[model samples]
Target: MGFDTFGDFPTTALEADQARRDAFVADAGGESIGVDQLHRVLAAKGIAGNVDLVAGDICETVPAWAAANPDVGIVLLHVDVDLYEPSLVVLEHLWPRLVPGGVLVLDDYGRWEGETRAFHEHFGDDPPPVERLPFVDATPVHVFKR
Candidate 1:
């Protein structure tokens, strides 16, 4: 399961590995999805394949989906595009879905204070048997493995 605020996508043009994704949906789906009015656009253009598109609060959705799919492996819980509360709520919910040895990666993690604090508190000096990998660059990312 994946979770995000849909504020903005990492890329544009919608090509290559993610080509199967709809450009409009990937870029602006969040706004439409959040409004609970994307079905028209989806049906008009055959965009249901990406039914993973959700229209609710991440905190509520992530854990619900995780609890239901105990067999799933490697669920990406991306929370960079939203406010701190929703992101934290969602992460708290999704954390349990990650099977032992699975990974949780955060994009633009080092750029925001709220996100950084949450990450640290959740996985402090001796975090739940997980390895921390912080990459530096224009868009730094943090990866935690359990």
Candidate 2:
């Protein structure tokens, strides 16, 4: 499952202002473009049924989804939320659901200080070793659950 507050910051005014200041929107359509592209790619690969996209604040959606799907164990979690609070929320809600040997990918790790700080803060002092993947735009890091 994936969570996002799409459109021209339809969630909150504060978030919209922040997005404008940060120039966070990749296209004119905002995050909806990314969501659409993801769907298109998934459909092309014949894996559209495997993924579910949730539109809302991660802080609210993640916990709600977790409670509703108690039996679900996440094998791979790819988090691209560029803010600290949401990143931390996703980790708090989903990290425990990740089974052993599961992998977690932080997509905005080095690109955004908030995201980077959230990862470190979530893991604390005894964080697992992360492998940084070489990418042109964002610095993504991954770690496997022991």
> Can you write out model 1's per-residue Cα lDDT over 1-146, one digit (the tens) per residue?
33544443333222332342244456656242332445466667886566566545566666677678777765454565424445466567667677777777665356544455566666678655434454454455667677
Highest TM-score against the true fold, candidate: 2
lDDT accuracy of residue 103 in candidate 1: 72
Give the least accurate 10-residue stretch of model 2, judged by summed lDDT: 8-17
User: RMSD, each candidate, Å?
Assistant: 10.1, 3.6
Candidate 2 residue lDDT tens string, 69-138:
9999988888876677788888888988888888888877766666677778888887766777766455
TM-score of each: 0.54, 0.76
- lDDT per prediction? 0.54, 0.73
**Alpha-carbon lDDT of model 2:** 0.73
